[model samples]
Target: MSEKFKITITTTLTLVEQFQSTLSSSQTNAGQRPNPSTNEQNKDLDPLALLSASATALKSHVTKLSLLTLTSPFTASAVATTLSTLNASVLPSLVTAALLVTPDSHTAAFQSEIRVLTNTALKELFFLVREIQAVAEAKASKKSLDQSEKDTVTLAAGRVWDACDVVIDVATKGVVGFVVRRAEEYRDLVRDAVEEIEEWDPDEDGDEFFDELLDDDNEDRPTSGDSDDDDEDSEEAAAALRARKKDTLRVLKPIAQIYPAIITNRLKLVPVPLVPSDVKVLESLMRNLQQIPEHIDEVAGALYEEDLQKYTSQVGKTKDCASRAINLVVLPWAAKQSSGDQETVGDKFTTWSKTWIKVMGEVSKSIDKT
Candidate 1:
C-alpha cells in the first residue's frame, strides 16, 4: 500500500513536470511570459503591484482596485508595482481610473456598452500590460511557480472562463436523443390531428349502429332516455367518437413502429462483478478524467479520493471514464499480444476504450496509477 502511494506521487510529479515543460516551451515560442518568471517576481515584491496597475490613459476605461483587492497575481507589492509599471509603459497619464477590479473599468461614454466594453476594453488592457516590466523586479518569485503551478492556474482559468455554453443531446439513441424523440412525446404532439379526425369517425360508426337499430329479425328495440338526443345528431356524436378512436390509433401508429427499435437497441451495461471498494475506487478515478484537459491537481485529487459526484456532469461530456483504466489502456494493450485475425473480447474493449479515451486524459492517467 505504501509503495503504491509512493509510486502514485512520483508518477504525478513526473507528469506534471512533463506538462509544464511543454507549456513553458510553447509560451516561449509564442513570445508570451512564462508564469514561473512572474512567480519569482511575486516572491520578492508584492502581489498587489501586478494586479492593480495605474491605468493613466486607459484609466478612463479602467476600474480602480482598492489596496486590499489589488494584490499581485502572486502578491500585493507585485500587484502595485506591476500596475505602476504598466501605466508608465502604455497609455497616456490622462486616460483616467475607475478604481475597481476587472475588465469592469471603462470611460463614461461606454458605460452602457456591456458587450463592447468588456471585450474591447480587455483587448486594450492587454496591449498596455504587454509593455510593462512589472514582472522583472522580483527575482525570487520568477523561479518558484514551476510547471505544475502554471498548469493548474491555466487549467482552472480555462474551466471558469470557457465552460460549455449549451447542453444538447444529438448522439444517436443515447439518453439525450431518446428523451427528445420518445414515443410518448410523439403521441402528445398529434392531439390536434386526432380531434380533426374524430368528426369523420362518427359517420363510420353510424353505419354499424344502423345495422343494429333496424334488425329485421327482432321487433323489439332497446330504447331508454332521450331518444331525440339519440337521433341523427347523436349518430354524428357516435361517428365523432369512432373517428376519435381512429385518430388516436393513427397518431400512435408511428410509435408502435418505433417501439420495437427502441427495445432492440436500448443501451445496456455489462455488469462487471467487483468488490464494492474496487468499484468505488474505479468510479473515483473516472471522475478525475472528466476534469482532464483543464484543471489538474484539484481534479486529480478528487478522482484519487473516489469522489464520484464531482465529475458526474463532466463525465457525461465524454466516454472516457467508462473505459478509464483496465478497460481501455491495459486491456487494449494486452489484446494486441494475442495472435489472431479477429480480436477477442479484450480487443473489443480496447477498441472501445480508444474511441473515447482522448476525451478523458486526466482520468486515464489516474487509472494507470491505480
Candidate 2:
C-alpha cells in the first residue's frame, strides 16, 4: 500500500508540474495580448480559464485515482492518504485558479459559478478527510480490525452523504443567486424598453406618417389633457403592457429554472454504490434529492412562480429506496452480467464501481457548467 501510494503521488506531482508549466506559459501568452477589454483577450487565452482547465484536469486524475482504490478493497488509511495527497498537492492549484478569477466587478454570476465549482471539489476532499479522521480516532483506541473496517466504510459512506448535502446546498444557493440576478436584469431590461418606447419623439426620426398624424392631432385636438376615448385607449394599452409583462415573467421564471433543474437532476447521478454502506448513503441522498426542486421553488418564489413541485415529486420514484436502487441500476447490471445465472460477484462489483465513476464524471461536467 505504501509503495503504491508513493507511485501515485509521484505521478500526480508530475501532472501538477506540467500544469504549473502550462499555466506559466498561458500567463505569458495572456500578457502579450494588446487589448485586454475585448474578445481579443479571450483569444490570448485567459489565465483564469487555463487555471480552471488545469484544476479540472487535476480533479479528473484525483477522482480516477480515488475511484480506483474505492472500488477495490481499500483501507481507511489508504483513502486518507490519497485524500491528503490531493489536499496538499492538487488543491492549491484549484484555489489559486478560483482566487485569480475573483473580480471586483462583473462578479455575481461568475463568482457563483466559481464558488460552486470549487465547493463541489472541496466537498469530495473534506469528505474523505472526515472519514479518515474518524477512522484514525477509532484506531487510536485499538478497535477490532473487522469492526474498524466496517466503521470506516460506514463513516466514508456518511461522508459521501455529507458531500452530496453540500453540493445540494451550494447548488441551491447558486441557483438562487442566478435567479435573483437574472430577475433584476430582466426587470431592468423591461424597464429600459418601456422607457425607450415612452420617450420616443415622433419628430426624432423621418417618419412622415407619424409626423403628419401628430400635426393633425395637435391641430384638431382640444387642449383638455386627453379626451375620454383617448384616456380609455391609453388605459387599455397600459393594461395590455402590464399583462404582457406578467406573461413574460411567467415564461422567464420557468426558463430560468431549467439550468438548476438540469443541475439538480445531474446530482442524482453522483452517489453510486461502491459498497453496501454506499447503498444506504445513496438512499439518504435520494430522500434529500427529492426535496431539491421544491427548495428551488421556495427560494425563487419571490422572483416568479416556476411550478417545479411536480418535478420535485417525480425524482426517481415513489417506491422504496432499495427497490428503486435495485430497479434502476443494480438489477439491470446484474442481469447484464448474468450468463444463465452464473455471474461472478467480482465482475458485478467492478461494474457497480464503474457506474460510480461514471456518475462522478457527470457531476464533474455539471460542476464545470456551473
Best by TM-score: 2
Reference-based lDDT, residue 100, model 2: 45
**Which regions of candidate 2 are displaced past 4 Å?**
1-84, 104-107, 139-370
User: lDDT of all predictions, in order shown?
Assistant: 0.32, 0.42
Indicate which candidate wins on lDDT: 2
Off by over 4 Å in 1: 1-231, 250-260, 263-370
Local accuracy of candidate 2 as per-residue lDDT tens digits, 1-370: 3555445444544544544454444444442433345434444434354444545455454454445343434454455465555556556656555444322221334344555555554555454444444444455466433555655555555544454444334434432343344434443443443344344332233578986888787866654556777768766755644443343333323323322332333223333212333334333433433433333333233222223343223222221221332233342333443554424433443355355445434433421232
Error of 1 at 99 (Å): 38
In model 2, the clashing pairs are none
TM-score of each: 0.18, 0.29
